[model samples]
Target: MQKYILFTVLSAIFIVFVGMGIIVPILPIYAAELGATGFALGVIVAAFALSGGLLQPFVGSFSDRHGKKGFLITGLLIFGLTGYTYTLASSVGHMVLIRTLHGAGSAMIVPIAMAYMTEISAGKNVGRYMGMLNIAIFSGIGAGPVLGGFFLDLWGRNSAFYTMALLSFLAAALVALVLPGRDSLTIEEEQGSMLSVFARMLHHRKVMGILLARMATMIIMVPTFAFLPLLMTRHMTASGTEIGMVIASRTIVNALFQMPFGSLADRYNKNRLLLLGSTIISIGIFSVPFAVSFVTLLLLFALIGLGEAISWPAMGALAAEEGHLYGQGSMMGVFNTAMNTGIFVGAMGVGALVDVLGIAWAFYLVAGFLFSSAIIAAAMIRPRKKTCISTGDKS
Candidate 1:
């Protein structure tokens, strides 16, 4: 029964993400066709991320005291309804407004769900469990573009938008019916403010180092993927199917490899793997500007996907361990905030680069950034001297 509940919840989450993912290869082009400039298009992507990132900490902190289920349900409702709003957007402003609402909904769901999972799966092989969520995440996202691109080829933009709306509503319905309501928020007044907890987390060398590495990971990812499709379509004369396949290649590799690497993280030195993975991703990103064929680009994306599969599961295990020590919701909030921040900054910044320097420069600059950030992470994120410690918390 518990297994069924878990599967249902995960499935619900995955379905909604398929909705979200369907827009990936389509949205930027849609915005541009609606008379948005390069910078405006970047803002379109960044707006959602900015709202999501900024709201996550506060919402996560609140959920720690209130209940995750309420926020999860409410957020999914907003998320579901907002997809239809995209079809109605006539201006960049309309898109931004819808994106802002969508971002808020995103902030509430994933991190809170993560906190719930981490808390429940205590003392288990957390990496493997958390990595399962990646399967749902990647598969939904992977499949979304494939279907979206097909719909675009057949019906047009509105069809894809409507599909997104339908899936979000489906996810909302599933969660309402299937997921258990466990409002087990056990916060004492003496535990200090969320700000204070954040301050402590900030000062903890291990936590901060991990956080920095995670932040860097997203900084490299968000911009590259956001802009790569644009380059593929414009420069390579790629079809929607080709573009979707190239993007989905990464997602497919990510979904396939997560659990295996996650299991390995339980037995191996995760910090080393993180460093190595970052380096591999850098290689993939740097090689992108040189690819002239669809097959080559697809292989490169797969390389990046392999790196992500290797590193993220390890990162998740470490994050789950830390969330247990601090406050689960708070830590997961910060963890997610790092992801959104990267999306926001990377989208905006890379958009500017695309406008000013060129698409090639955007690729080159992000690759350099990825390599440099990996170096810094390798230098900073050292393992603790003692092993098998009960708590991953540091003061």
Candidate 2:
């Protein structure tokens, strides 16, 4: 039953992400079609991210106090239902509202699922579990664009949303049947309120640094994926399918490298992996602005994938270790909020900049932020120490 629940929950997460991935390449185009300006598009993207970011901590905390299974079901149902509304959106406002709702559902689902996973998996193998979870996520992301493009080709834009809706519904049904009802962590109010807990986590030098690193990594990523199609179309004369291929290439590389990277994290200094990944990501982001050809763009994105493969799992493992004292759910909530906020800021800010300055400048700006992140990451992380304990020889 435990194994069934774990696989089923993971599958649900994978399917939910498929819906997210399928929309990635097409969303900006949809916004443009709805008469949205670049700034408007940025706002539209940010709205969803912001809503998710703001709600995640609360949802995670609530799940910790109450139970994960209920929130999981509620979230999945909302995700499935709200996903269908994207097809009905006639304006950017409608799209923004629906997207925000969709993000709210995601906030409930992701952190709660993560908390559940932490409970189910043994402490020593947490990184391995996280790697497996990421496989599900990246696989969904990898397949989403290809599948989305195919559906769009066959049935058009509305078909993409309808397909996503169906997937979400199927995932929800799977979760309802297979996920066991279990509450893993006990909540102690004396540990602190949510705000205080967040503040305390922030005060921990390593925890804070990890959060910032996560944010920086995501900030670079959000803009790259968000605006890649626009850049491809405007600069390289690429079609939607070609753009999807470029995005798909990144995910393929990410999936390929995640497990190996996770193993490396277990064996070596995880911080080094974090540094290496961030540096690689920065370089990839920096080079993306100069990618004038489709092949060049694909190669650069693959490098970005490699960077992500190293950074994400290592970071997750590190966070798990740091949060060993705190409840995993609370720490994960904080982490999710940081990540989602970064995505919000990156997407909205870069989208606005693209509108004002140009697409090239936007990519360059993201690259700069990533480079800065690499520097900060190196400065912040240190080697873990081992303590030797001894007993008296005489009895």
Candidate 3:
């Protein structure tokens, strides 16, 4: 039953994210066509992150008490609708409204799915389980960009958006028809109110470290995802396929490395591993402005992906370990909220920086922030203590 649940949940996630992946490279270009400036682009992405970040905790707490399947299904349906709605947008403001709605739908999906997966795992080898989930996510995302590029090049922009809608709807139907109506594990009513739980979590050193690390790592998204396409267009005049391949490189590398890094997370000092990964990511992002060719950009992005692959399972495992103390749904909600908030900050900050200091400086600033956060996270995460047997005779 657990295996079945994992498989079903992962399938739904992969399908849904493939739809999301399909739009990633295309969204900036589409928004650009609607006269969106760098600030406007950031506003659009930040809107999604802010709305999703705000709603995630509440949604997670609600799912903890009620059930996860319903929220997951509803989120997928919303994604589908949002994809189609993109075609109807005439201005950046319209996109912001649409993205805000899309974010609400997002608040229901990934963190809820994470909670459900964690619950079924029985808290053992959590890194491994999260690695599997990441595989589904990264693989779907990896595949989507390639297809999105193809669709855009051959069938035009609307075709890509239409495909996103179709894929999301299919994912929703899969979850509705295939996944169990309720999770195998049950949550007790005495888990406490959301505010109290959050207040307590905020004071916990390890949890705070994890949240900060997550937020800091995510701060690079706007510079990488939202601005990279623009950079490539202006610098290299890269084709859509070329752009997709560059983005896909990072995701594919991350997906490919998940299991191995996840295993390492279980065996090593997770905080140290996370710090190492973040440093690598910072270096990669910092080097972006120096890339003179498409190949260099692809390589740099892949390097970033490798860094993420190392960091993600470690982060996921830590969150899962913490989940036992503070309801899985709530913990993942907080965890993902940190992620969204990071993106929100990145989008707004980087967008404005691009307007003032230029895109290169924006990457430099984000990279600096990531490195600083990584150092702080490493300092804050508690090291595991070793157990030893005592000998009667003294040496």
RMSD of each: 3.1, 4.5, 4.2
Q: Per-residue alpha-carbon lDDT of model 3 for 252-353, expressed as tens digits?
A: 999999999998998988988899999999999999999999889889989999999999999999998988888898899999999999999999988988
In candidate 2 the C-alpha lDDT for residue 10 amounts to 84
**For residues 1-395, what per-residue lDDT tens digits would candidate 1 score against the true structure?**
44655676578779988988788778877887888776787788788889989998878888887777778888888887898889999888999898899999999888877776666565478778777888888888888888877877888888888888888888888877776676543442334788998888788777776777777778765545567778888889887777788888988999999889988888888888888888888888889989999999999989988998988888877887877667778888888888888778777888887888877876777778877876776666675456576576423
Segments in model 2 whose C-alpha atoms lie over 4 Å from true places: 184-190, 383-395
Instruction: Estimate the lDDT of model 2.
Output: 0.78
Worst 10 residues of 1 by lDDT: 182-191
Q: What is the alpha-carbon lDDT of model 1 when measured against the actual structure?
A: 0.80
Per-candidate TM equals: 0.93, 0.92, 0.96
Better model by TM-score: candidate 1 vs candidate 3: 3
Best candidate per lDDT, number? 3
Between candidates 2 and 3, name the one with more favorable TM-score.
3
How far off is residue 106 in model 3, in Å?
1.0
Report the C-alpha lDDT of model 2 over 160-225, residue by residue, as the tens digit: 887788888898888777765665334424456777777777777778778888788878656666
Q: How does residue 332 of candidate 3 score in lDDT? A: 93
List residue ranges in candidate 3 displaced over 4 A. Answer: 186-189, 383-395
Evaluated at residue 284, the lDDT of candidate 1 is 87
